[model samples]
Target chain A: MKQLVIHPERCTGCMQCELACSFVQTGTFQPSVSVIKVHVFDEQASMAPYTCFQCEEAWCMTACPVNAITIDNVIGAKVVLSEVCVGCKLCTIACPFGTIFYNPESNKAFKCNLCGGDPACAHACPTAAIEYEDSETKDWVGPWAERLNESFLTALAGEPS
Target chain B: MIAGWVGKVLKVDLSARTHEVQELNLRWARDFIGGRGLGARYLYELLQDPTIDPLSPDNVLIFATGPLTGTNASCGARYMVVTKGALTNCITTSNSGGHFGPELKFAGYDLLIVAGRAASPVYLWLCDGEVELRDASGVWGKGVWDTDDMLREEVGVPDARIASIGQAGENLVRFAAVMNDKHRAAGRSGVGAVMGSKNLKAVVVKGSGSIPVADQASFLRSQWKKKASLRDSKGRQNFTQLGTSSTLMPINAIGALPTHNFLQTVFDGAEKISGERINDDYVVAHKACFACTIACGRVSKISDEAGGRFLLHTSPRNWKMAGEGPEYESMFGFGPEVGVDDPEAIIAAHWLCNDYGMDPISAGATIGAAFELSQEGVLNGTEGVLEWGDAGKMLQLLEDTAFRRGLGDEIAEGSKRMGEKFGRPGVAMVSKGQEFAAYDGRAMQGRGLSYATSNRGACHLKAEVLRADYKDPGHEGKAGQVARTENQISALDSSGLCLFLNSGATYDDYIAEFNSATGMDLSMDDFVTAGERIWNLERLFNLRAGITPADDTLPKRMLEDPIPTGPRKGMVSKLGEMLPEYYDLRGWPEGIPSQEKLAELGLEAIA
Candidate 1:
């Protein structure tokens, strides 16, 4: 399933994503409405982008009293259904990541739905900090270490392989 | 109905001790947009008499917010403080990015128009729709940070935001700045002095309401995408990493970083005072305004080189504070401008300016001018007080100037006035009575022309040609480039977006955001045209104030003195060569706009 992934180191803390999200979801520019948040640690000279982790055993999906939340099969994104949402805010409390939020204007719970399999946040990102990738197909780590190990082995074999 | 707009105008008359509230004129809001543009329109309407003293009760200070401010938009926490400039004696509008703007929006007011004079020192407090004028006698004499803290305590709300002045403004320093959020400031054009003139101490705001937008869903979605884009942008990277000081090396490399009071183009110790050095030496923490995703602000400190044998070490003033910046200009102004390449000295001077409440640009320029005069034996009786590269003496001068003490009294009046007093008016390096920012116009002709012709005088942020020229410095297409950039920048400033956003977004992107927010069918042409109209209006204001075509020229030094070294060696700004072309492109005859063009811009009657 396609999942939204972030390379936090690449984040510049511009908050263009927050603006984009708030504009799309609420039709106004308000950071409170943004699902994705960028927290900056100035002392360290770094910025980290946080969003819905989209866990396998999602606490929000199971905690919804009226079953208002559902997981999308194509993108593995947990989405909120306004029609089913009773504004109970149970999912917001249940979610450990605090990504799921209740919109005061709509009185309904809202979370990242991965923008229908083509997330606008990723699309608009100038630095390609965020990407939508097939979690199962793509190797998330170890490539660099593997390449280094292979090079060391080739050196031991006395060949430029 | 934009979510953030309060749709109201708050008017206060200090002389009468009266206040009134009025509905914001939707027509004006839609046409002029907001912030600087709206404030300009209001100022034009209110101040018909061109001779009104900038510090008099007759003068007006208007704080205005655009349609985008307080919205969910990125970097939308901007507001304009508009008044007659104490520095230039012309139209001065300074914008600051902080929670104060957003809080003002939440208070359900689009604009705060303060007019007339107060009987005594007072402050205006606004809580949502509740407004009152209270005595500020106790905090009147305090510095910006102290006043802010006192006001916050008095209001008993830690979240309450305050914009106040310091000793410089109280002493009527021509280049005083209006500080807010402890460090952020409406930091140019002497807005603070104007406030001090009115006997107003501070404007405190506490807002707890939300801004309503036309479409919540769409705005949220767009905001998210914009956030992501900005988070990854190269501009954002540079800003986040090095703050605005990132421009130091590039500008220095291009010989645009003004050195030695702009008498030289190259600084041999540029790297020592560069952004990388700042990051490595004294960046204590990164700071950001409320809702700002791009945390470009730095709260830095330097304590390594204290108690040293320096001119300023008459008393050990150990420096440790988290001020907003030593942005590229400040670094240049406090660093090479005075021939002091020490980063510690630069940071100390920066700290003193913030603590004492002075505009770094004006202060630095004045000191630079003084250093030059001293070097030439022009200031013979000053007792070696004005030495180049003497950081301690610089700090001492800054203190004296802020308080208008002895020699400080002369320097406090700004370089233009001081230079005239010293019988070297031509060497003062000012236009419209305001001092130059950090860019040496000799290196970049376009920037030189921009500085010469800028309504507020010698200000780079007013209109920058360096960004355009960075790609092609020698391009003759610079006139059009300046015009286009000036127009768009005017629009953006009016729209309440941070100018830094221009690094990642174009006019089209801004227009898109504007259309989505206001639901106005504004085209790219309309947007640019509005900027043109705004520019013309400012020009008309200056002309009405008796500033003529002759005033639209570079400093004699910038025009005649060729840079001694660097890539721009032997180069002088050809402002005279470019002015006519620039004037023609601006739809003006010679250096002044024609009556026909004025009429087309709805400025004929005013002119």
Candidate 2:
């Protein structure tokens, strides 16, 4: 499945992604409504674009007691159904990354749905800081996931078989 | 209004400690637009008596934002601070790019006009529609950064952005600057001195509201396309790599670097102090303003061993903070103009100006004038102190000038005043009272005309004739070129967009952006017409202040001293031939705008 990925070093802190996200969802220029956030560090030397990682376990989807959140198979994107949402904001708290947010205007939780397989944030990024690609094929993510799994197995083995 | 504009004006009177709200005049908005255009109109209205002192209680300061300021627009974070100039006797308007402009728009005001004078030092805090003047006695004497921090603490809003002046402004240095964001500045025409004179130290703003746009859907789509266009443009690459300092090598290559005051048009050691050198030597990171797609700002630091020794030797105050920059103008002002080729030394000088709140252009030009005068045996008792290319002495002089100590006191008054005191009135390379910026007009004829005819005195940004002149070095059609550029720049300034964007975008692009945000059906012709109107209005204001055709001419050195070398060798700016054509193109009869032109713009009553 395709997933949104970021190359933080390429980021210029322009916030074009945030503007694009806000415009697509909120119909206005609002940074608060943006699902993707660009945080500047080192006195603006480096910028890191952070967004929903769409984990395999899908913590937000499991935390949504109202069954308002679901992952689309085609894009591997966690989407919030506004119609079913009760504005409980449980998913916002459950998401460890804090990428899932409860937009005050919409009164519902929102996260990057990858724009039905084409994310606007990736499209709008001037420096290619954000990208959309197959998650398994991307070399960086594949190794990261494998390393995480290996660490989990090692911990389990050491616990005492 | 569907465009991203709040369409309101806020007026504050310091003496009465009262505030009022008024609708932005629609006709003015349509014709003059916002930012510099709005600032010009407000200044013209407030300063009817040209004889009024610039630092007097009656002098008004207008902080204005344009229609495109607070949108998802590329490089839209800009604003203009317009008032009577303390450095130059003429009208002054300085533009700055930062988040303050966008915040002001989000707070729902197009313009904020400050009139009268406070009894004591104070800072104005603005949040949404509310405004208040708070006592700032504690932070009054502090530098810009500390004052900003203290204000944020006092207001209990850590995110509140502040624009403040430093000791140079408090001491009434003629070229003191207003600094914001610890780095960006409204750094010309002594606007900070005016702020200090009024006993106003800072203005902090925190806005948490949206700027309503007329056609939200269209605006969003247009903004998206603009981001892509900007990303693909060549100008963005140049800016990303070399920043504004990119112009340094090219200008130097063309023999227009303005070395050793204006006595010579070329610097021999230009390569060492060029923009490429700065990037290779010191630049650690690139920066951007709020919501800007083009991150052209360079955040650089020089190593302690490289040029750090100069900082240690000169002033103990600015020891180890990462020095801000040697931007193109600062590089020229402190580098070639004064004959100093050390990049690290240039960086130190740049930091000194920022820390003490001095405009580097004015400070460097003033020192250059003093250097020239001392060389000619004109200055009083400067036998061993003055020497060309002496970085240590230059750094020492910069410190003195910032603190108004010793020789710095004389230089603090500016080049024009310094020359007058030394009994050589014409030696200062200045127009009106403000010193000329980095460009030398002998090689670039159009830039020469721009410097001469600039409203705020010898400012290149007001009217850029370099590109046109670059295409054709000869003075053919330069007048028309200067006039057209001046109009376009005026429009851009008023619109609160960085002029750098104009490299990739056209007037139509700006018009589309403006229309998208303001919901005003403004055309390219209408936008250009507004620029023309603003240019003429500024000219009229200067005329009323007693500036004449004579003031619209270059210094004798630029016209008489031929460029000694380079491609355009043995050339001088033919201002005598160009001025008449420039005046005619501007629709001014014999260097002064006709009463009919003023009447057409509703400025006839003031005339």
Top of the candidates by lDDT: 2
Question: For model 2, what share of native contacts is present?
Answer: 0.55
Model 2 Cα RMSD, Å?
Answer: 4.9
Question: What are the per-model DockQ values?
Answer: 0.12, 0.37
Best by DockQ: 2
Name the regions of candidate 1 deviating beyond 4 angstroms.
Answer: A1-161, B1-4, B304-321, B381-385, B471-475
For every model in order, the fraction of real contacts preserved is: 0.17, 0.55
TM-score quality measure for candidate 1 = 0.82
- Candidate 2 deviant stretches above 4 angstroms: A42-44, A55-67, A88-96, A102-111, A137-161, B153-158, B217-221, B224-229, B306-308, B312-323, B381-384, B600-602
Tell me the TM-score of chain B in each candidate. 0.96, 0.96
- lDDT for residue B515 in candidate 1, whole number 0-100: 75
lDDT tens digits by residue: candidate 1, B1-607: 5334668899999999888999887776776778988898889888988668898889999999888888756777789998889888888889898778877877778899999989999999998778899999898777776787789899998758788888888888988888876567787889988988998888999875556666555555566667667776888877877888888888888777788788787788899898998888878666556556676877676654452433234311323334457777789879888888888778777766765678888998898888887777778755485767888778778878888987788888889899989988865878778887777777777777788778777778767577776655563777777788788778889887888776555565677677777777789889888888888888878877777888887777888888888877888877777888889988898778888888777767767
**Per-residue lDDT for B578 in model 2?**
91
| Candidate achieving the largest TM-score | 2
lDDT of 2 by residue, B191-266 (tens): 9888888888888888766666787767766766776677678987788778889988787777777888877767
